[model samples]
Target: MDSAVITDTKTSMKAIFSDFKQLTKVGLSLSVVFSSVAGYLLAIDVINYFTLFLLALGGFFMVGASNAFNQIIEKDTDAIMKRTQNRPLPTSRMSVKIALTIAILFTVSGIAILYSINPKTALFGAISIFLYTSVYTPLKSVTPLAVFVGAIPGAIPFMLGWVAATNQFGIEAGFLFMIQFFWQFPHFWAIGWLQYEEYKKAGFNMLPMNTKDKGAVKQIIFYTVIMILVSIVPVLKLSGAFYIHPITAIIVALLGIYMLYFGVKLHRSEENKDARKLMLSSILYITLVPIIYVVDKFLH
Candidate 1:
């Protein structure tokens, strides 16, 4: 092989890799997969490695497809936002044809993998993609309620794993869903707070009150309170299969308080720095709480 041919091949491979990463939003997809896996772990006494792999792969494909479609739909707005200007679609690093192809492939592949696990898991996975791309993506430019719409798909993952494991829906699954559902409010609101100006400039209605003021901060704090309360509810149930140990409850509550402290600071100070801190804490809170659930289960 000629040196120039080898160099060209390497460059083409790098571009392809970069496009795949950007299109899938790899880090975010992995985090979503982690939540699904955590839910699966919590719901099952024995681990099936093949089922676990299928869950992670199918979950990633579903999330990646949604992100791809979102990027394609919002390519125009994304091109305008500082945070998204350099993405594959915006920079012309990837053609719409290629992006669309990847999206369709992921969608099909994801559904098939999940269908192998259970029909319920596949149904919820399909619902997630539809709601995210068809409903949530377009709503971002039209209403602040887009966040609420987006949360529906967002909340599905944690409960999704439960359904995949047990192939049935119950209060335990609903509990997991509610926990993630409420958690998104504070998580995404902090993001809205941090990116208000950019999102506004891009014609995206992310903030609840459409302004970065007392209204938005108040709502953030309100949701944070609800989120914390929801996180502790498992402990209140004395007769459930999903109740966590009291010690784990204390740990989760402490994490919630850590997140809430930043929420309050963001409210009082009205500082972007605190909003950023709140965002980080929310990430930490979500990440740890699920692991704590699994650990508390084993130790119970």
Candidate 2:
């Protein structure tokens, strides 16, 4: 082949890969996978490497598929938002036909992988995608209550791993789900606060009260407190089969307190800087708390 043609082909391939990454939202999907892996580590007495690998793969693909459909549904709104305007669908970097094909493949493959683990895990995976794409995606522009609905699918991966491990839903799984469920409030509100203008441009009512006011900030602080309270419940022996060691519980409490500090700061200052700090601290709290729980479980 001609040298020019070869160079052009390579460039095209690179662009395609980059668009694929945007379509999949790799960073967010990987965080979901990490949570799923942590849940698996917590549930199983003896870790099965292959099963963990499958859980990660299935979780990533399922999340990617849900995100792809969301982008497809909201392509126009995404084009209006500064944060998402450059996404593949919004920018015409990828065609709807191609994006749909990718999403279908991801959905099918993800379900199949999870089904290999157990049918219930696959069922939850499908349910998450449906709820996210069909319900949460469309509801974003309709009402702020969408955040409450969106939390269901958002909190699934952690518990999905437990289902994959034990093939049952019980108090332990419920505890995992509730922790993430409460955590999303503060985490998402902080983002809603920081990106209030951009989200407003897209007509998304993500923040409580649909405005960055004292009421919204107060809700953030309230949810942050609730999240901290829930994080310590396992240590108090309130949650069945979900106990954390005393030392680990203290560490988790300190992490939660750090997140609470940012939430309180955001409330008092009403500044985007504080909101952004709360957002970062929320991420750290969720990530570290899970790891600490797994480590503490293993050691005890």
- Go through the candidates in order and give the clash count of each: 0, 0
lDDT of each: 0.93, 0.93
Write one digit per residue (lDDT tens) for candidate 2, span 1-300. Answer: 999999999999999998999998999999999999998888999999999999999999999999999989999999998889999998898999999999999999999999999999999999999999999999999999999999999999999999999999899999999999999999999999999999998889999989898899899889888888888889888888879878887898899899989988887899999999999999999889889999899988
Consecutive 10-residue window with the lowest summed lDDT within model 2: 240-249
lDDT of 1 by residue, 1-300 (tens): 899999999999998998899999999999999999999999999999999999999999999999999999999999988999999999999999999999999999999999999999999999999999999999998999999999999999999999999998899899899889989988999999999889989988898968888789888888888887888888988425788878888999999999889988998998899999999999999999999999998887
Query: What TM-score does model 1 achieve against the real structure?
Result: 0.98
Cα-based TM-score, every candidate = 0.98, 0.98
Q: Residue 156 in candidate 1 has what lDDT?
A: 95
Q: What is the lDDT of residue 250 in candidate 2?
A: 87
After superposition, the stretches of candidate 2 with alpha carbons farther than 4 Å from their true spots are none
